[model samples]
Target: MPKAYFEPEYLNALVEVFHEAKRILERRGITHPVAVDAVARRILSLAQEGVPPWQILGEVLPPMTPEAAGLPEVASTNDIVVSGPAPDTER
Candidate 1:
């Protein structure tokens, strides 16, 4: 049997709302997919960060963006790692 076509539960939850939101925005000439998705992604990120659903919706609705909630900043590390040469073995 083929694997199911259904999206993972987590993905579906995130996409469904955004899909609806994007369509509404597009119909209103908000064709900038990047900005639309940016907003959706911000909302979803806030949800994943444990923001209360109501609070997230309220904050995202108007006069606010994800940055307004003062979410904890994520620290980033350099992608490249440094390594020293292998040590020589004594006979």
Candidate 2:
């Protein structure tokens, strides 16, 4: 069985592109254009770190508001706010 969230192969390919981009930067000794590729690499790294792809996407792409995380103000759920930490499940 797979984890509830799985990072796709295309995402891995993007990471590779970033890697290649970095080499180019180092070769040319110019990192001015590195920011975009660097950000891509960071998102890919986060995805590899076991974060859900959706979460990674949210961090990378824009128009992402606190609402998307199911925060109370957006979710219309008064019983519990979806913001803050994930609820403790110990009890």
Candidate 3:
């Protein structure tokens, strides 16, 4: 398959946007490699379509909840079930 080549200025813009997006994610405690790579791919896709860096950032980083930010879910009291010991079945 033919590789897509970008002009130097466009390539620089893409790189800048990618790094900026990554920094934003990291600030939000999203340092996972997979998440970073996914953001990079998204930035590239948008950049190829002539999207501005600010727009790319806006589109890529939506307001995410703790779950979406890769943080562990905290179980609420309603979500927790307390079970008593099982009664002897042979009694």
Return the top candidate by TM-score.
Answer: 3
Tens-place lDDT per residue, model 3, 1-91, is 3234256756776677778787788888889999888888887777667676556777888767888678998767566556999778995
* Full candidate order by TM-score, most accurate first: 3, 1, 2
Off by over 4 Å in 1: 1-8, 51-91
Structural similarity to truth (TM-score) of each candidate: 0.40, 0.33, 0.54
Q: What overall lDDT goes with each candidate model? A: 0.59, 0.56, 0.74
Task: State the TM-score for model 2.
Answer: 0.33
Quote the lDDT for 14 in model 3: 64
> How well does candidate 2 score on lDDT at residue 2?
32
How far is each candidate from the true structure, as Cα RMSD in Å? 15.0, 15.7, 12.0
Question: Which 10 residues in a row give candidate 3 its minimum summed lDDT?
Answer: 1-10
Q: Clashes in model 3: which pairs?
A: none
* Predicted candidate 1 versus true structure: per-residue lDDT over 6-79, tens digit per residue: 33654565555566666656654677868787878777776667664445544554433435555666557658
Scored by lDDT, the top model is: 3
Worst ten-residue run, lDDT, model 2? 1-10
Clashes of each: 0, 0, 0
